[model samples]
Target: MPAIIYVPFGVYIVTDTVEIPVSSRVIGQAWPQIMATGSKFVDPLKPRVAVRVGLPGQVGVVKIQNMIITVKGATAGAIMMEWNIHESGQGSAGLWDTHFRVGGAAGTDLTVKDCPKLSGKVNPNCVAASLMLHLTPDSSSYFKNV
Candidate 1:
């Protein structure tokens, strides 16, 4: 049976990837954040996903909406989200009003004081992620107002 997961408005720190299974509907109130942190997501060459939607070759309904995804501390290799679910129908799988925020904000340790753009040099510590989102070849999704 399909399940509805409701996340309240708050900050959630995740040291590892959060996987969303098939036939699941995730709704967040007031734009809850799923923040990634830790050494596991620091290698740019071997990037890892912070949020994974469904397993490989999974065909079903997976909906995620009203959420904010971000990275904290040193996460240069973090891919904010990976979509791998093949939709069961035209509008079965999708994300709405969901957004991604990397760094340069509060609680991210990447403030403007730490990573100034006019500094004439890039600060490695301000590197938030390698990629924002990854849509696998086999995945099909309908995203609106993301």
Candidate 2:
């Protein structure tokens, strides 16, 4: 069985992170975006990540398509998506037609980080500052117009 989740066309305001479980594909309408409240400053030590995927023992394909992620007023984490590291038999993931923007704050940007999977390669400067999306080791993910 295949299941797909949809985010309606419009701007949604959120203060906390949104979690998408495994084995599901999240689709957006007209490039819907999730905007974080630009008033709160995230802690540099423990920043609030925007999206998280892959729960424990989740061995099904996951996808995120057609969306724009924006963040402002963040001290650290900013607008970022995290992929949990699996032990074995990991499921595949794909990102299509997605865009990430980091601006509007004093000094903040979007970022994607997985410490367990990408430990020694990811630039510490990217993690500490700026917006970036880093792929994992041996990941068969595809991206288009992102």
Best by TM-score: 1
Q: lDDT for model 1, on a 0 to 1 scale?
A: 0.92
Residues 1-146, candidate 1: write the lDDT tens digits: 88999999999999999999999999999999999999989999999999999988989999999999999977999999999999999999999999999887799988887677888877777888898889999999999998
Cα-lDDT of candidate 2: 0.58
Which digits, one per residue and each the tens of the lDDT, describe model 2 over residues 63-100? Answer: 77888776544435554665542323333566788877
All models: lDDT?
A: 0.92, 0.58
Backbone clashes for every candidate come to 0, 1
The weakest ten consecutive residues by lDDT in model 1 span 113-122
lDDT, residue 82, candidate 1: 96
| Candidate 1 structure, TM-score to reference | 0.96
Q: What is residue 80's positional error in candidate 2, in angstroms?
A: 1.3
